[model samples]
Target: MTRCLRRIAALALVLCPLAAAAPAAAQDSAAAEALFNRGLADMEAGRYETGCEAIAESHRIEPKLGALFTLAICESRSGRIAAAFTHFGEYLAQVDQLTPEQKSRQGERPKVARQEHDKLARLVPELSLALPPGAPAGTVVKRDGRVVDSAALGAGVPAEPGEHVVSTQAPGGPVWETRIQLAQGEKKRVELQVKDTSAPPAGGLSGRRAAMVVAGGVGAAGLVIGGITGALTLGKKSVVEEHCGSGIGVSDETACDQAGMDAADSASTTGLVSTIGFGVGLAGLGAAAVLYLTEPTQREPTAGATSRRIRAGVLAAGPQGVVLGASGVW
Candidate 1:
């Protein structure tokens, strides 16, 4: 019984690595096969983007000529000539001889892919990114989120004709980045540069100055509304006075009474609207003043920067029931 136990322990020890690796290996194989099947299905359905992504991911999981060829075909169908050309060339670069079964499945496809790739090279756009003489060492380049190696940088990198985001950074150094648009068959070179955040803000006002501008706008809008509502209130009051003024010289006293009551109700509504507008306008102008005072004094207005930028001015409306007013800057 002791010898039997000892043999079991030895077997466990001998198989430890295999036991640890089995789950991961199984997972990878299953994922690769699923992606490959999905890619083939999507390509057959003419879903170029989805098919390309699945095939590319399958190849990443386990490199295969069939996956690479499918990816190239999808890219071509999607109008990504540059990417298709590169992938097709890469597929042809695999010099390993295929088995009779494999060759039968993909007969003449290899020749056709290579022929299309050569023709595409002349018609595709490329982006050449070069660092200046003083770029910090250990600076790595990236396109979108993927690493672009030094070998790819020597010759221009082939890409789809559109906007591409390029980034570069060195260890402990600030990252430099930019976006460039490539036209079909155009070879464009871009030199990346770092951002300078130390300088004061540009283009438009910043901090409280910006707030002041916005507050001024709000104040102006409030003033306009207040004015309209104030006019309505006055018109309603005039209407009430005309129809029934002490019931003197008004024919049909009962009709005058009804008209007066209706006008009074309308006047009440307009009065409320006017009061709200005037209050909002006042608050907006007050906010503009506060924003102007609290603005950063350190930022001296750069050249061509206007100080007032049309600061808040006055707009007054008649009383809703009591006193009413609106102040603003145009």
Candidate 2:
């Protein structure tokens, strides 16, 4: 009898706790449902913030798929389309496990989610841009006064669909701005004239001309010095030959020797001057050549602004325009 009583007591001990906890679990579920219902009521009353908070709190307790779907609806009505779309996708994924009645109740939720996503997609603005020749690649492109992506500055980026302001700027170039209307899936080309901030200063040509004139003057001076030295060398050579030749008699030897010595001194002086003048002239010519070769090339001003376009997933050339891309757009 004692054994039977002991067995019965053990069974009761185990079952009693479960029985006691069952009502507590039910109460918790009821509380979660109450919060969810309150959230729905708040959302219907246009109190989106309160509704979302309450729904989120209910999800923390019970994690019901229906509560998540209701929160997504609230997000969509509150202009949080991206977040709404994400939640809606999650809700549809979970609805597969619901009963037949529940499934019927949520029949059109997926369709509504897609429609909301499409509506947000339409809000993306279109962009058109012009780029100058020689503009650096990876320039930033902006649309509707906001940065799209610098990578959108070139070929392969699909045309933006809508009306928007388009602009572009390089590291040192003037900003180019224009407005464009793009149809759905229609590509339009635009050109923007950007002034070259990299152009040389206005005095660049005048400075080059002045340098050329200075070089010419130095060349003329060297030539004149060389001519004088050549004349002196010729005169010295003739004097030396006439005085030291075999035609001279013994009495005239001393005078002839003196004349020879004078001529040799003059020849040495002339040779040294000639060498110096020749070296100077060569150096001046080399300087002039270097100056001419190293001078910056002149560029002609373009009539209009430079522009580029975005096509495909990259920035691409538009009809009659160039394309560019970069790390960012602004």
Clashes of each: 2, 30
lDDT of 1 by residue, 225-253 (tens): 87898898898877777777555465654
C-alpha lDDT of all candidate models, in order: 0.73, 0.65
Candidate 1, residue 38: CA error in Å?
A: 2.1
Candidate 2 lDDT over residue span 1-330, tens digit each? 999999999999999999999999898899899999999999999999899889888888889777887888888787655456567767767776788898788767757766765664554233334465676765556766777564455432334455556666766666766666656534445544454567455655455556756765665676678778978998898887777655255455435577887897888888777766655554455455555655544222223433332111113422222233233211
Work out how many backbone clashes candidate 1 has.
2
The C-alpha RMSD of each candidate to the native structure, in angstroms, is 15.3, 18.3
lDDT of 2: 0.65
After superposition, which runs of candidate 1 have C-alpha atoms over 4 Å from their true positions? 1-27, 96-106, 150-154, 168-176, 195-330
Best by lDDT: 1
Looking at model 1, which ten-residue stretch has the lowest summed lDDT? 296-305
Off by over 4 Å in 2: 98-102, 105-107, 117-330
